[model samples]
Target chain A: MQFWPWYLGGVALTTVAVGHWLLMNRMMAVSGRVTALVNRVRFGPDKAPALSGKELEDALLAATLAAFGDEALKAPPTAPEPAPEPAPSARPQLTLTKPQGPGMHALFFFGLAIGGLLSVLLAGGLEVSPSLRGARFEALFDGPGRYAVLLLGGLCVGFGTRMTGGCTSGHGLCGVSRFQPASLLATAAFFGTGIVTSFAVALLLA
Target chain B: MADPPCPHMKSCEMYEIFTFSETLAVWKTRYCQSDYSRCERYQRALKGQPVPVNLLPNGHLLEK
Candidate 1:
């Protein structure tokens, strides 16, 4: 089966990203969703005076009303644009549009996983193998040891992402596109460390 | 590095209101401090639309 072109994935990513911002006015940070899930489980809602269920929906409605005016309550704008810099004299202020809770994050997480599965299925590449997928992976961690390595690697990734305040999708895609300096720096650090780690792992396994 | 504060904070009316008025400080936290991209005034300005002086960040009209 022919593999999908790399740019198709790029196009999909771009569509999701632009749509995320346009629809939600929020940054599309994949790891942030994980953070939200963990925080929800560990500490409860991020905001004080927590609103849940219908109240949460109402609050969102209120925010939407505030964002788009009275008429917007009827029909919300589809393609929201980033607010521009003020001219000579104007200040920044915003209505607090809270991030979606863990439930939404779980949905997003599942969506990502299911989307990948669907794409693979469509490509006719669905196959089950007990051994780790790559020769390098099998060499590095044979049998059940691969699971341990995967778990440990996942922990490291989670920790690193929380420490950095974002993962590749956040810093690399959204931040870099916005020309945010910190995002640029974070993206560089991520790529730099990733390259070094891959080479080190290869050497060790070899 | 920390996220940069809104560039228009110095001359913005909402900045003054949010700074001096204790109750409105939440606006500062949500938009002025971190992400001004979602600000109504900022967005309006970006689109070359007229932003009224009494317009609040949430797009609500501020009552005098």
Candidate 2:
């Protein structure tokens, strides 16, 4: 199986990142997008009230009247008494438009997963044999123990990503490409932590 | 009756009239559960095609 050159992959990523900015007017930060979605769900509808039924009806009536122009306004009242205008509180509350939604972020992650699956299939299926041979930590822990360690690592990664406001793709790929100072600092911290952890693990296992 | 100003109006001077949370609330629901696949831009993305700048609601991807 043949793999595409690393530079080609980089070029593709760069194109997508730039396209995201130009087309969506948004920075391509997968973690931040996902976090925003999560926050919306975690915070209920009360956090941001939708237009009340009366407000919606009032808005529709106003739009209809605007569309009819002077003819609607000039029409003589059929009844002896004219209808009163709705209260100010019943008016629709205007709000800012969002650029993108959670669904896009969900689809983006789905694409990432599909891309990985395609790469593995193209590489001629998954290898069944044990690939981690003679690793110091593998000898120290049994299968179940190794899984526990993995679960813990996974939790740490999820928590860390949330706390740091990004992951490798968000900070390293998109952020660094844009030359953000905070991203540079975060990326450096990520590498520094990984190096320190690896040495710590080796010492403990030995 | 005068039409209500759209919350998304680019002018920042209107900030005093509307609170930050009110603005954020509108954005939160704009694309929260929207179907991106229905968007022409998203379809272009799926086919590995170029996206146009004037595509509908580039962020929400929903035609208002």
Candidate 3:
């Protein structure tokens, strides 16, 4: 079994996490991309915004001024440190529009599949095997039941991803690298659960 | 009566970033303070969407 070394996998993961942000200025969330694809299918195309880039910036500036007055820009220095609690009354009814389309994420999701295929092709010739390719999985889920178990496991992963709003790539790689508290907690939970589950499975199989 | 800050302000990366940059004050003033409902991060958080750390108040990603 030819497996890529851990360091190489780490490097690739870092590049994907950091390069995505460097190039696109957005967090690389594989689950988010999947969600976006699902949303694109469910909701059809998002209402494309009329403005972007400089136009959007200018519009935001204008809206900010209207909402908070001319002093809004300069009032920062005078504003209390640690941010005062906001008064709830009389907020301006304004919403800034943004261009959000799932097209890029859809491509990203497909790109992941292609990347995996390419990696497999480059490492070793692809084999079309109907068997579950792991000894543990074989022991535990030999037969057509394996596919059903795999489906259930995938569903659980998807559900958990949606519930947490992130997954290993998003929270584990990007969030942990950035030292986000939420990410740290999430990653800890992920690893903890994974360890316990694996142990439980091993004991059950034994 | 002072209402609470944006529910996510404590954990929001934008709030942390805005704390240092004088030019970005309008973000804190306009959204983080009272009109947080208008904030894209706030809206996304409300919808149970994954709010990226660099997602700005106006829903654009913070560019380098």
Docking class of 1: incorrect
Tens-digit per-residue lDDT, A1-206, candidate 2 = 45667987888788878887897766777777666666557642222223334453344334334444444344333323444545778654543333355677788888878876787687677444332344886787677777787778879988888776688878888778778676798999988999998889888877
Candidate 1 per-residue lDDT over residues A181-201, each given as its tens digit: 878999899899989988997
Q: Give the number of the best model, judged by TM-score.
A: 3
Candidate order, DockQ descending: 3, 1, 2
lDDT of 1 at A11: 99
C-alpha lDDT score of every prediction, in listed order = 0.68, 0.54, 0.71
lDDT digits (tens) for residues B1-64 of candidate 3: 7656797886675586556434457778768987898899899877865565446787765332
Runs in model 1 deviating more than 4 A are: A46-94, A128-132, A204-206, B1-64
Query: Which residue pairs show backbone clashes in model 1?
Result: A83-B43, A90-B12, A91-B12
Best by lDDT: 3
True contacts kept of each: 0.02, 0.00, 0.12
DockQ of 1: 0.07
Off by over 4 Å in 3: A48-58, A65-100, A128-136, B1-44, B49-64
Q: Write the candidate numbers in order of decreasing lDDT.
A: 3, 1, 2
